[model samples]
Target: MGANIGDNLFSIFNSMTEYMIDAGQRSVLYWDIMRRRGNQYLEHMAKNIPDVLKFDYELLINGRSLPEPVNYGLLKILPPKGVAIDNRKRPFVVIDPRAGHGPGIAGFKADSEIGVALSEGYPCYFIGFTPMPEPNQTIEAVIRGEAHFLAHVNELHPKADGKPVVIGNCQAGWAVMLLAATRPELCGPIIVAGAPLSYWEGVHGQNPMRYTGGMMGGSWMAALLSDLGHGNFDGAWLVQNFEGLNPANTLWKKQYNLYSRIDTEAKRYLEFECWWGDHVFLSAAEIQYIVDNLFLGNKLSGSEIVTSDNISVDLRKISSPIVCFCSKGDDITPPQQALGWILDLYQSVDDIYASNQTIVYCVHEHTGHLGIFVSSNVARKEYFEFASNIDLIDCLPPGLYEAVIEKINYDTVNPDLVTGNYISRFEKRTLDDIHSLGCNTLEDNRCFATVKRLSDVNYGLYRIMVQPMVRAMTTEENAKLMRRLHPLRLGYELLSDHNPMMKPLEWAAKWVSEHRQPVKPDNHFLQWQTLYSDLLATSLNIFRDWRDMMTEQMFFGIYSQDWLQALMGLRASDAPPRKHPGHDPVHLAFIEQRKKEILAGMDKGGPREALIRGFIYVRIPEGACDERGFEMIRRIRAEHHDNHLSEFKKTCREQFFMILLDARRAVEAIPQLLVGREEAGQKFFEIIRKVATAPGPLGKEADMRLAEIKALFIPVRPEQDEK
Candidate 1:
């Protein structure tokens, strides 16, 4: 009996251990399957993703046969539905960033920037390139080509009222700004969405990406990487760096979310990945110049950069109205980087107005960098409102205005649906508001100066010792192979019969679908899963936050220390003091003359006549209402039976000509016109009331004309205001 009991106990323990081992194996298998299944799902989605977006984009050249001019091309867009063909506005040009992606994000949906413009009866032109730059095409060459493209657009729409509005997104933002600065005459309003200008300015712990250069020893790594690529910098590397910044999203969180709701989320993930996966490349020279000069060295904002022909590129030289669109939640190009340039270049708001520049900015509270340009909701609201109200912005006075778009009830009847009544109120902002965003410390500027010097040394060393070997090893065939074998591309391409594990996944997917037991939307299991996922994401973010803080602290500590500053010959203050250089005498005199002419014209007429003219001018459409307003002036001339009417015509003609000569001048004179006219109208009303009530019988014709004039000057009735 004792022997039997011992044997039974040993058997029971063995069975228990076996069961434990089986459970452990099943858990491991489940996790492994989850990862592979997620990847497989992504691959399937990528392969089957439909091109929901339609663009007339002409492919200029295949990167494989590059070195030559474009062999193929297509127009990126066609006119939208429902607009009459004859009256369509000139095409507006929009260029999307090719930083780590292909194009089409700007016009990817019906509620996109391009789409909004199209809906407004504007022809849309998109500037997009292939996955590679032309073999010998430099950035400067591309800039010249883009300028030529704009000139062509101008020719195509010769009768259009204003110049084409060119919008640049992300990396294209700076490119468009450079174009405007260099050739301001070619475009009208320039919109730069989410572009970084003052690269070195960032909050201490919040923006850690700026400190990456200092943490990695100041662009030496960039030089080495370019050398390794044999005189070309693979933009995929840049894409990887972007992914590294948000590891939770790039690694697990994003994929896990898709898995948890794979039935619905698959399409969205694939749409984004299409652009994200299509990596582009930049020549070593281009990437190096951008890094050493703009990113790490911070030269563009400092007025230290020069073009290839040795021409100075100044931001202040851009004469056209600039619209800066930035978002607070955008980690890539935060509000600081977007608005900091104003503080770097100007001393005060007066400086900006003195230059006759209209700089308007709009800040979205919580959109991410990509969402600023791509989110349909944002595109519908911000972009649609911007396109419709661009003329109002163009006509704003020379100063800073924060553009605010408020939605209106559409049920209310209005005259022109296209010109729906919008309450556009411009709030004044000062240079100090812009400066407080992230104007850098003196120590920050000095450190960047040191970085510029060190970059030159590192680049020279690589060219002399390492570049030649790299060039010899990188042949066209090998480059093609390298592209095909890239992990991101290969991961999708290798999931067919080529992978043995994929065979079982097909069966598993079917089985899982057939026997699927999805958690209820509000089930405790789902709630727990969500809580766990949030915890994981929070942990990853905390790690990233800490890492960034450490990186920034280290950078400031090393570069700001007195001993290190001395060794690097870096100054702790801003550059040597420079005297204030005033404005050009010729331009100042011209502006003063224009201002005087407008003021003089308003002073000539009696209060009632001046008020009538002001109201007429504001309401009438340009050129269209020229006849109507001029007719009213002529009627007053005949009826007054006085030389005042004749004198008013002469002054009106002169002031009108001054405005036609320069739109900027005309807009600047509006406020003074409005103020003077209001005062004159009040005075005229008082005088007319006294005359009418006086004892002498009012001249019948004079009384009638006066009544007619008063009717014209009266403000729109409250009932009419409702319309």
Candidate 2:
């Protein structure tokens, strides 16, 4: 018994000693990681918050020098070694979100949106902003500046196949739509990755972030923050809000991941932190407009936001094909918010058709908001497939569709026709499809409506009661001090060399690294540490869920009261909590005029028209289209015609509408289209046949359509013509 007790004591002592050594080693490595992070932050700041784009770029147009004098600038990304840019191909203009952090999240790495465009031989450009805004610059000015940048890109690549493909990340996504709506001619195909146009949209139980405005009493806090900052809203506040959405990730998992994998995780952690830490500023006017119109009023999708010059912003004005890439895992911009604009703008899928708009949306099941733009996996697959098939999307018939990308399997038909590792196809969708994802009910909308009304009241009260004193007390020096001491920046400041306490840490960390002795994987203490960290994270997650539940309950309870709704000028039967700006008369006239033109040209044109018409007719019955089929058509067009992509798109749209208007007349008129070009008709039918078979055997309906088209293309011999 004595010997056993002695052995137990020795074992306990040995375990304690090993734990201390391991703890000491981990502390040294963790602080070293923090020190490196601080140094990176300092370096990134010293460079004036330059973009994190991995590729080299040359400045093209500086928005500060434009007539609008905004802080945005356009950069032309240079092709890397062994990459050749084809000016004839469409250009890609990637706009990073300037919500809080500095730009370049869109192209933060080599395998990113910009990289995919460059790999596909498209000229790439970036629109990034500086850390500081131009004095008195407004959001409208920013939109105009972006428009000018796009026009310049268009001029630079006059020989390109189509207008520049504008890609917007997060905040930039809505900005892209705004630009496209106002200046429709400048945008080609638009891709909005993790962008939220409908701010109030979310699932009922999840996406607690949407309720934050109500919980905080609305835009008044934002106004107060801007006033306290001396007319500049600190972007760190926005970053903090994002972090607050996931307490487990923000409070424990992130740091613990680094602490546990100190040997291998520092570089990536520092790289991402460099972007996250270097916050930017928004002018007071800008934030006010964003919160008032977008966040509170939920106006952009409804066409309710008008410009200072009295021009209303209408999303229906945009003619480009819009591809929204959102993720189910994104708590920031849920798929509902990313796609809710469709339901807002159109009452039905037919309205989309009437507007002659092509909207394609893709929802990723697992990618987070940042991953939508940053993950190398997403870049290699989604971005690559998107870049390769943009032309296909652009040429699709004007309507709603879901872009479904699936892995190639053994059952895949003609797999060689599909490019890369995945095959991309667009399946028809409707507003019902968006509704199925999840949306706010009438009661939820009424609650938000009340919040908006109360927000305006509170904002006015703050402006009258608090703004003057706050402005009087705030100064540039105080603002700078406040920004420095922000919780987000405090960590970097405290861990940096500037802190005398941390000064000794540099050398000590180096010494410990050289003499490092890592604990074995089977170490009992190490396992216990991991368990403790996980439990902490789990606890935080539970707290977050409970907090979110309380917030939601509070928001709904306060805003959903009948008295509050009545006070806010909203009733059960009055106007909807929000009303969509009905169709513009001029837009209606334009659509009518387009219909007249389509009717006039239904039976016009010769081989080109017949070829495109036949392709549409063959695929229309299937109710789905794939990039493989579109690519085959593009190759056929390239070999047979020299028409520009814009012209081809125009003809395709006209033919599609013609067929939709009168399928029997459209098919019967095909013989007239092939009156003299019978040989070309045969070739076109052959092209359509190849495309139809490339994916697999067509459905019965599609096969019948193809037979009808083939019969139309058959020439009558002189001897048999008498019969």
Candidate 3:
């Protein structure tokens, strides 16, 4: 017993020794990472906040040089070694969200939107802004600057296949859509990832960020912050808000994760911090407009925003295809907020068609808000597939659809026809499908409506009574001082080499790296340390949930009060706060007129039109079309030098809507379209057959439809002589 006790004590001594050494090494490494992060932030700022995109770029059009000058600029990406760019293909323009962080999250790494586009041989452009905004720049000036950039890109790629494909990340998504809506002809296709279009739409228990404005009593606080800044709003305030959404991450897990895996995690942590820590600034007018028109008023989708020129902004006027990529795990921009615009803009699915717009959305199961645009897996699969099949999306019929990307496997049908490891399908959907995702109850909408009303009242009172005094007290020098003193910035400034207190850490970390002795994974103390970290994170998460619950309850309780709702001009009803005005007479009449025109031209074209019409008719029952079928069609079109993609797209749109108007009549008229072109009809029929079978066997409904089309293409037998 005495010997055993001595051995146990010895073991404990060795364990303690190992843990102390390991902890010392990890501490050195972790602080070194933080030190590097701080240095990178300082360097980034010194460099005027250069984009963190992995690729090289050259400035093409600087928005500051435009007639309506803004700080934004358009840069053309220079492809890396071994990558080829085909100017003849559609150019891709990526606009990163400038909400708080500096630009390049959209192209921060090799496996990103820009990388995927370049790999596919398309020229890519990035629209980024500098750290400082031009004096008195407004959102309208920014939009005008973007319009000029697109026009310049158009001129640069005059020989390209079509207009530039615009990709908007987060906040930029709404801005891009607004640009496309106002200048419909300038955009080819618009892709918005992790963007919130309907701010009030969210699940009750899960989404807590939407309650922030209400809790703060609205944009008045934002106004106060801007005033405190002497005009420019520091982006760190926005970054701080994002951090507040995940207390576990903000308070402990993020730093603990690095400390636990200090050796391997430093690189990635530093890279991300390079972007996250580099905060930018927005003009008071820009942030105010966003808070008012988008967050509080929720006016973008409602088409209630009128420009200084008296032109109303309407999303339905966008001639380009709109693709929305969102995630269920994204608390910042939940799927409901990302896709609820369809519900807000149109009363039904047919309204989408009548408006002649194509909207496709994809909801990822578990990616966070940043992962939607930053994760390599998503960049490889979703962004790659989107770039690969952009033309297909551009040509899809005017309506709502869900983008479904599936990995190819042994069970995948006709895998040979798929371009990549995944096959993309656009499944026809309805407003009901959008509703299926989730939405707030009418009471919830009314609560938010009250929040908006109260916000206006509060902001009005603050501006009237307190603004002059605050403005009188603040100056540009004070604003700059306050911005530098922000906690987010102060941390970096203190940890950087400029601080004498941290001067020893540089050498300490180097010495630790030289003599690093990592503890074994199964070490008892190390195991306990990990367990402690987990407990800390879990506790923080619990606190977060509790805080969110309280916040939500307080917001609803205050906003849903009868007197408050009455004061806000709201009542408890089945109707939502924001109601879609049913189709106007002018739009209804236009739909009828367009239908008559389509019916008149049912038999207008020859073999190309016949093939497209027949294909649409046969595939209509399936309710989805995959990349495999579209690839076959593209191959066939390639063989015919006379067929331009633009013409092919027009034929597709016309035939698709015609069939939507009257399927039987459109199918019957296929023979009429192929009349006097028997040989061509036969060839086109064979092409369609190959495409239809490329995705393996069709269903019974599709098979029957194909058979009907085959019969239409068959040559009529001459009457038997004197039978």
Candidate 3's displacement at residue 621, Å, is 0.4
TM per prediction: 0.74, 0.96, 0.98
Put the candidates in lDDT order, highest first: 3, 2, 1
Tell me the lDDT of candidate 2.
0.88
- Over 233-342, each residue of candidate 2 has an lDDT whose tens digit, in order, gives 99999989999999899988999898888778888998899898889999998899899999888999889989988888899989899999999999999999999998
Query: Lowest-scoring 10 consecutive residues by lDDT in candidate 1?
Result: 620-629
Q: How many backbone clashes does candidate 1 have?
A: 6
Best by TM-score: 3
lDDT of 3 by residue, 54-101 (tens): 989999887878888899999999999999888889999999998999
- Worst 10-residue lDDT window, candidate 2: 634-643
Error of 1 at 462 (Å): 3.0
The lDDT of each candidate is 0.63, 0.88, 0.89
Model 2 residue-pair collision total: 0
How far residue 647's Cα lies from its native spot in candidate 1, in Å, is 23
- Candidate 2 segments exceeding 4 Å error: 1-19, 641-643, 679-681, 715-723
Error of 1 at 172 (Å): 0.2
What ranking emerges by TM-score with the best candidate at the front? 3, 2, 1
